[model samples]
Target: MPNSLRPSSRAAASSARSASLADVAALAGVSTGTVSRAMSKPEMISEATRVRVMEAADRLGYVVNGAARALAMRRTKTIGAVVPRFGSSSFPAMIQALEATLAEQGYTLLLSAPEGRREKEPDILRAMLERGVDAVALLGTDQPPAVLSMLAAHRTPYVQMWAPPGSGSDAVGFDEHAAGAQVVAHLAALGHKRIGFVGGRSKDSERARHRFEGLALALARHDMALDERAIIETEYGFAEGFTAMQEILGRRTPVTAMVFGTDYLAAGALAALDQGGIAVPQALSVASFNDNDFAAYLHPPLTTVRLPIREIGEAAGRLLLARLGGEHFEPPPMHVELIVRRSTGPA
Candidate 1:
């Protein structure tokens, strides 16, 4: 029997979708072998035939059986991404850059959001390996020791993102601590002291914690004290900012200025303060990290420290692509910028 007489690698996938390669071949007006050759090794087939076969496959909505291909060729041509969650602004941008870069070199991105930070890194690595991912990208470098050991054992190429100084793995990120410090310094230089901190939980994000620490360092430099009640932890959203502001408002001594870990939180604070009938910059000054797209749209606009998310994403894509191409390059520490805007003034 000809190789095409046997089931094609995509047969199982077709069955799952209730379609078949015969369906593709018949629709293409070509032989089964022609369809197989066109789909598997397009370079060996005539351009007209390849086009016809691809069009038919597209019309049929054929799905590639990555598992079978991985078994046959020992390559899945896919990279895995493990992040905190999907649909977030930052992760999606990074994924887009990575996917575009991989597609340019004939690869795909297989995404998995493990709900939250993986507590069992070993199991997570095992799951990706089981799926035959060529590489994996993790959101941060705060993995458990066993997870790091698992990666070393598998000898897979992995990249860690959003890291601080002295990262353990190959990484692409900026100094979160320095970013926080920059915001505090910017606020202080504008004559605002007695700062409050609003941010995400310290346990989940080392970067968030570092930002808070940077705030402390900057305040210390100015002989300022951040009140105990002024530090509020939220779940990295706008709602958290609102809650943090409520707590701040309830304080005995009102804060003069505030720095937040993210613009999302800052936006919440702005709304909360407005609802409380408090004036901004006159009664309270506010600054935040992550000079996100919406930062400039607020009533007074936000004074924010730029996170360099796009640059980091682009750089991450380039790094992964170069590695896939067998080229060696060191990952660089990207920098953050402070964008002084109207949200902050004398306090």
Candidate 2:
């Protein structure tokens, strides 16, 4: 029988032996090294030839051994990122940007979250290290000492995202304190004398602490004071913001405006005000940091600080690639802008 009529020969060979690079090379009419290059470093190979090799490998059910490849290349071509929480607030946008940038350069991303527990970050990072990730990106510079020491011991190249300039570490982010001061300035300009703040726990979030500090500084500048009772520290969640707002209202403090550390929290506060029949920008004005996607769609539109989240993520990815490429340079600090919407007015 003709070879086309009878698949016995090819089927018998495929069944008898596990496919190897040489087998794929033979089927694609390429050399073994070319086949290897096509799989590991496809950029160096022409597209047509790469397609031929891939098709031959698929037909033979050939699977590249990542362990073997790593051993040979001394790289897994994978990058890892550790954040406080995934799918929370603005992190999803940052992660998407990071993933897209890395994919363009033939790298994969491995993400991890500490589930709001800073103490667990070190263990999570150690696990990523053990998995042979090429490099790592941390969310902020406020990492546990153990985590910093571990990264130092491993000599891993890392960059911190959402951190300020001159943070004494490789980072790509904006200044949270300045962002907070901007909000206060806006409120003060609107004739708001009494402003309350709803935010997350200062101990768990450096960003929140800086924002609160900035608020206090700006309040003093405006000859105003933040009522100790008006400042509520809660978790970084919508429910937490709602409850904090409710508690502040219960205190009956003469707060004409509210500044939230994040837009997510501000959103919750808005919900509470709506439910309590409080007219925003009339009875009270609201401002927040982080102009997340939902901010513009909120009732009355949220007035917030517009952080370059996606740009920061993309910059972080580029920094990692530069390190891998043996290029070194300090990145400039990103800037934040104030977005005035319907949420804030004369108070």
Candidate 3:
């Protein structure tokens, strides 16, 4: 057939379908491999070829197929993250920091919506792994065996956030148990004898369980105990905190102070206390964890444990980046301070 009988190169590049690497290579007068190198590792190709391929790609409105690129490179440059739930304040804050830190290193964050059920974690993580994520970021230190096994089978690099320093994976967090102990010690030092605890479910939440344990032990040290009648374990929510506080009040346990697992819960409990005509620190001292910005902004200004949340997130991201780079990076130690505010006082 005559050259005129064949489709023109420009017309072929402008086909209705999305332009492919072949079209770009053809338009740039280069090979498909050269186009790949020019798009991915431009340094590997000549500047002239790289610019020509880029211009052709631009003209064709060609978008790099991430999946195909990952297939060729064996890395997606994305880190998958799955947390217990998004209902809490701290995780979201930590995630934001993690995303920003990862962005600094040019890694996209791929999040799994909810690791609500422990049993569902395997599926969630599996979906993430199947997407060719370079690494994973989990909320807790311990994972169900299936999840761990799957990760191992795939040889995926993973790190845990807000977890104790163990479990055979890179982890970044302050000691949850210590945070609890600090909170109790602060309240007890203020002469709070009868302290009630409101927290997320301990059965599935490792952090909650650790905090509960710390509170119990610290209360023991102070000659008090975690009173069952006054303790309420609920989901991570403001309304839940409010309801839990009301329930604690109904228990008739006569507590002088209340400790919440997180600032979100503390906020709700404060609302409940205010609505119930109880004065903070004056009537009942209230303290909690995660010194979120709102903690200082609350009416009574919560007395809580100030976690290095964003720093922890940045550290976690750095740990993963180090792992990817095959460099040695320690999970830096983070401290949690007992921020004494007007929310707590003499009992």
- Top model number, TM-score: 2
Q: RMSD in angstroms, all models?
A: 5.0, 3.1, 5.0
Query: Lowest summed-lDDT stretch of 10 residues in model 3?
Result: 1-10
Score every model by TM-score: 0.82, 0.90, 0.84
Query: lDDT per residue, candidate 2, 110-158, as tens digits?
Result: 9997678888888999999999888899988898899889888988888
Q: Tell me the tens digit of each residue's lDDT in model 3 across 41-81.
A: 78898777777878878878899888776787778889999
Alpha-carbon error at 235 in model 2, in Å? Answer: 1.0
TM-score of 2: 0.90
Residue 134 lDDT, candidate 3, scale 0-100: 93
Q: Return whichever of 1 and 3 wins on lDDT.
A: 3
Q: After superposition, how far is residue 26 of candidate 3 from its true place, in Å?
A: 11
TM-score of 1: 0.82
Please say which candidate is ahead in lDDT: 1 or 2: 2
